[model samples]
Target: MLQWKEFEAWVCIEGEETVEYDVQTSEDDRTVTCWIASELGKKFSIHWKNKAFLQDVGGSVKVDGNPCGGTISYAWRDLGRTISKSGIADAATLKSFVFSSLEVTDDDDALISSSSSALQDLGLLELTIYPVRINGELESTVFSRLNLSDLKVHERSKKAVTQQIKLAEPQPLEKAPRVLDIERTGPEVVKFCFKYRPIDVLRANGIAPSPSRLKRKASAEPPRALTPDDLEELADLEEAKNLREKLRALEKKLHKRDKKPRIKDEDGDVIDLTQNGARNKRVKVESDRPFISGEVIDLT
Candidate 1:
């Protein structure tokens, strides 16, 4: 919601107050601007409320810089309440306000496709309020002439336009709304501007914060506390690893023992002499005779 003096305005989606971002006011506080996220094919509306004052006040609204067909006049008796421009009167019917995505195509006239009004003010909703006096004439509702196809531009000229205000299906209205004749007495006392775009576009432009996941992925999450079960499982894994290390050490020792050179004693007992010590027996043999281990021959 945006407010100045006693007037307040907001954008609505499906009758609920839509979120606004980057709300700002000029130094004088007469002009207020904000960014709003739009979803394609979603219904939306403009809403406002004013305070009770001694004099009557009125205003005009522009959706995408074109006058939206509705009157904003409030006397002392008609203040302090919220009002919404849910839809527009289209020839005795009502067309719901909608947010729609723009389609960009490769037009054959790509070389000379002129920028249309639809592209200039693609996604803005504004309200200008001022002091007014009741006149004796009647005002007419200006139906929006923004056709969805009118927004389709050449691919080369698509620029940054992604969404715009479009009308939804027209429903039957038994009677159209009444029009009031009111004239502005002075310049607009306050102005509210809402620039709307898709959520992706907003994130791209840094107007709204990126989705929570983009910032709060698990890599950034705080370390979780370990439970008793978690500690027990970790302890069991460490014990298993220690047991494997001991087994490897034992196997390595056995392997070393088997690789050592061995000899036999005269009593036919196997002996190992790979390591030398005082008690190690040295067997004398004639190199001229071919001898093999683990074999004995009988002398005739």
Candidate 2:
């Protein structure tokens, strides 16, 4: 909820319609005081009627001298009671102060009870500026109010605000693990190591790992120079192996030939081409010559 009095003070001093203000300085010019007349306050009547005073006003304030590193509080009093209060704190630089309104009256305040015309007759506001320093450090200059007895106050309930937020769950800790490192030894090779896992053997060489077994096999049975007798024996053994292979092939061919049907005549008698069978059927001839077909021959 916006403090009406604080907004009114800020807007009257810094608003676009503010135009200018009257400033009075001390004899030494180290302190400056400023305020606005009620006639000038009339220009903010529209704001008052539309309750514009209930909004926040933001502006920066410049004091004539540097502030001490401390805080100062101010309050507007009417009829022995506090109507509004504000606070200012000296920044770390000690050259300026940050201001904030602590409390302010609502629309029912006595200062704003009368019409703008009537309020103009009374002194609107005043600021008494002074520099306070403690421990050689500049404390915030306190502004004391004066001649605000004619103001009134109207009380109301303060505004209430509530906020809700969602928070994420915290993460759990992780356990320690053995170190694993990988490095490139060459364009086609990669070297890897695990401190506690004995993994240096997995290093990739330029060739595929499948041929490693072949290398082992070659080493297992190394080749040696053959003696003369050994060479001759090997040649004989090779010849015997070839002869055995040929004999097996011949046996296979003879077995296939035996499986065929024997040649027979129309009377179903098997024809024997052996010497005795040929002599029994031979045609008597004076010389060894070809026999003519369809010749009747005697066999004794």
lDDT against the true structure, each candidate: 0.73, 0.28
* Candidate 1 pairs with clashing backbones: none
- What tens digits encode model 2's per-residue C-alpha lDDT throughout 126-235? 22222222223222232221111222323332211011011112223253211112222223111111011001222232122334554745456669989999999999
Using all chains and alpha carbons, the TM-scores for the candidates as numbered come to 0.64, 0.17
User: Per-prediction RMSD in angstroms?
Assistant: 23.6, 39.8
**Best candidate (score: lDDT):** 1
Residue pairs clashing, model 2: 68-138, 68-139, 69-138, 108-154, 109-154, 110-152, 110-153, 111-152
lDDT of 1 by residue, 6-88 (tens): 77889888877878899999957689999988888889878777775546766566776567655564675668877777666
**Model 1, stretches more than 4 Å misplaced?**
108-118, 137-149, 213-300
Candidate 1, poorest ten consecutive residues by summed lDDT: 140-149
Q: Which ten contiguous residues of candidate 2 have the minimum total lDDT? A: 189-198
TM-score (C-alpha) between model 2 and the true structure: 0.17
